[model samples]
Target: MNLLRAAATVSSYTLLSRVTGLIRDVLIARAFGAGSITDAFWVAFRIPNLLRRLFAEGAFAQAFVPILGETKSTRTTEEARVLLDRVASLLTFVLIGVTLVGIIAAPLVVSAMGSGLRGADRASDFDAAVWMTRVMFPYITCMSLVAFASGVLNTWRHFAVPAITPVLLNLSMIAASIFLAPRLETPIYALAIGVVIGGVAQLAVQFAALARLGLKPRISFRLKTAWADPTVKRIMRQMLPATVGVSVAQLSLLINTNIATWLAPGSVTWLSFADRLMEFPTALLGAALSTVLLPSLSQAHAAGRKEDYSALLDWGLRLTLLLGLPAGLGLALMSEGLVSTLFHYGAFNAADVAQTRMAVIAYAVGLLGLLAVKILAPGFYARQDIRTPVKIALAVLVATQCLNLIFVPYLHHAGLALSIGLGACINALALLTGLRRRGVYVPSKGWGTFFMKLLVALAVMGTALAGANTFIDWLAMQQHAWLRVGLLLAMVSGAGVVYFGVLFTLGFRPNQFKKGGTPLV
Candidate 1:
């Protein structure tokens, strides 16, 4: 597959999902506002969401995809099918058990996640969160299966299906918030119901695609058969360390959620809104690039093509810088305006916008690092070397909590965002250092010149954005949604024009961006 083409396919679909997700969030903010109800919903939603990432997208995908790709490339078709079935059987059994337990232990989980809710004043929100948690628990089981199917398709180079599956999630939530919430006595339960529906829908779409690819998994409970499979054992081995590496990052976020619970009523909601905005660029670029790169990297490693593996990593990093820097800086610069324009209306007041913007800027400060983790972690995972990343993630987690202790006292919820960014930067740096120390990756030539050009381009874009910012009254944006959106679009377009124009003027060409899957000299 053409790496650039595949990334674009994934990015385009992901962009659509984020756009709809933004709409869903906008409705949510209008209906619920940034308070106890919204906070409860976010916390409840996060329990299943975080577990889905930990089990499905993060460690599970990392472990499954490499092995799946290798099996497809190096083994017989019958053998690969058997491996897939056995893995599916084991995952299905485990996830079902986890889902049942998670539902049963919702109160304990909620209490552990947000102990601040234990206060008498917050008991209502605590009970609400626990109920919502049970409602959303089954989502983990559905998405775990979806993730496995996604791995199968990604190994088969069916990028569009998995990329597009997230749209169902955004649509389900949007429909729930707008259409279902108002009808319900407790509106937030609609969102939880939508979560379960979306998970099932996501799983169904991927399952259909897998059937079309003739890779439909045969489900079973033959533990002896599964344990007898060497490939399954290898995946389990990789999953152990990969889980720690993945979970530490996610656990840090849970820690932030825990910390946010004690701050103020709107703290959880504010951080969540800012995080949604960050996910826009992150899903479009970071996730899309990582999704496409992992299988390719795995393919290279499986074939013992050391040089190709290095070049793919080099190519991914260069692309990371090319896109990530401008995105992070622009987001930090435009946080206030962007938040107000997109989200400030109805129950989401100016104060909410202000708080969310601060978090946005804080999170954007480490946007590059966040994006880098997506690209870099795959480098380690593709090689089935999970210990290095787990150690690095653990160290970063510790330092981040330390920063959290220091910054939260001063920065409030925004400090949590900042610490997350700091942890991401540390994580990315450690991954890079490990890659270099192992001599598995070497930077390509012209990196210095490339970065210099990037700096110049970024400066030009910043200047353009600053000039555009002068004409808009941010306070007035809350009253005129269309006007705000129009102005934001124009400013973003002009900034992009200036940034890319400068790069073009400095001898960068479209062809340069398209040149991937080539060995670096």
Candidate 2:
């Protein structure tokens, strides 16, 4: 696989999804605003969403792809089909059982995630959280199946459908928010319904694609036999560490949510909104690079092309820094403007924008670290070394909890943002250090020069944003919000132009960093 081409394709589709998600969040803010209801809804929704990320997206994908890629390479088509069928059967059974347990335990889960919602007056709020969670819990089951199918399709070199699946998920939510949200007695209920519907639709779309690939999965009680399969064991071996790593990450979020609940009414909503904004760059660039590079790296490693693996890893890291750094800087500089323009309408007031902006800026500080993990973690997974990440992730989680405790008291919701960001940086550093120790991350000759140029470009970008923010402030004094928004956007575009244009002029061609068969280091 051409890593760049795959990254481009996945990034394009993911960008579309992120854009739609932003729109959805904007609409959600307008309908629900930042309040007790929104907090309850977010807490409820986060439970399943967190599980989806931990189980399906993180652990499952990390494990499934490399094994599936190997299976496709060595096994006959018929043999691969049987392997997939057995794995799917077992996965479906496990996911269904987990979802049933989650539904049955919804109340306890809500209570754990939202300790603030106890007592006589807030009992109704706690009930809302439970109800919404039950409604949304089925999403975890559907999404897990979808993730498994996605792994299969990706291994088959069919990325478009899997990449596009999230777009359908976002669109489904957008439609429900637009039409169904207002009709419901509580808009949060509508959003909960949308979550479940989107997951089902996401799964259905991938199922259609699987059918086209002649790999339609069926639910079966075949676990007794399937669990004994060698390929399944290999997958499990890879999955175990990843499951722990992802669970640690999820637990960090759960901790943040639990803590945020104890803060002011809008704290959870503010954190969620800021998280969505930060995720745009993450989902677009970081996720795209990881998704595209993993399969390629796996194939390279399987082929014993250590040099190719190293070069690909270096190139991915450079690309991540190149894109993520400026995006983070821009978000940090324009956090207030972004929050004001995107959400400061209807029930979302100036205070809400201020709080969300703080969270957004704090999140921006950690953006590079998060992006680094997205790029770097794949190096271990692709090499079939998942255990190290789990170890590193555990350290990161402990660090995050410590930071959360230290900062949240002083900064409120924004402290949670800072803690998560710092933890991500620590995680990325640990992963990279481990890779170096393992001899999986040999430094490339161009890394020094590439990083030098990137830092220069980023410095220039920051200078431009500072100048533009000053100009925006001057314009804002005119008291025209629309003009301020337009000017701020223009300023951001101008910064991008200067940054990339200067980089190109300084001999920083994007293609120069592309990995060939040989390792540059």
Best by lDDT: 1
Candidate 2's residue-wise lDDT over 107-155, tens digit each?
9999888888775777878899999999999999999898888888877
Clashes of each: 0, 0
| TM-score (C-alpha, index-matched) for candidate 1 | 0.98
Model 2, residue 293: C-alpha shift (Å): 0.9
Q: Global lDDT for candidate 1? A: 0.90
Candidate with the greatest TM-score versus the true structure: 1
Cα deviation at 308, candidate 2, in Å, is 0.5
Colliding residue pairs in candidate 1:
none
lDDT of each: 0.90, 0.85
- lDDT measured at residue 303 in model 2 versus the true structure, 0 to 100: 83
Weakest 10 consecutive residues, lDDT, candidate 2? 470-479
What TM-score would each prediction reach against the true structure?
0.98, 0.96
Encode model 1's per-residue lDDT on 373-432: one tens digit a residue.
999989998988888889999999999999999999999999999999988998899999
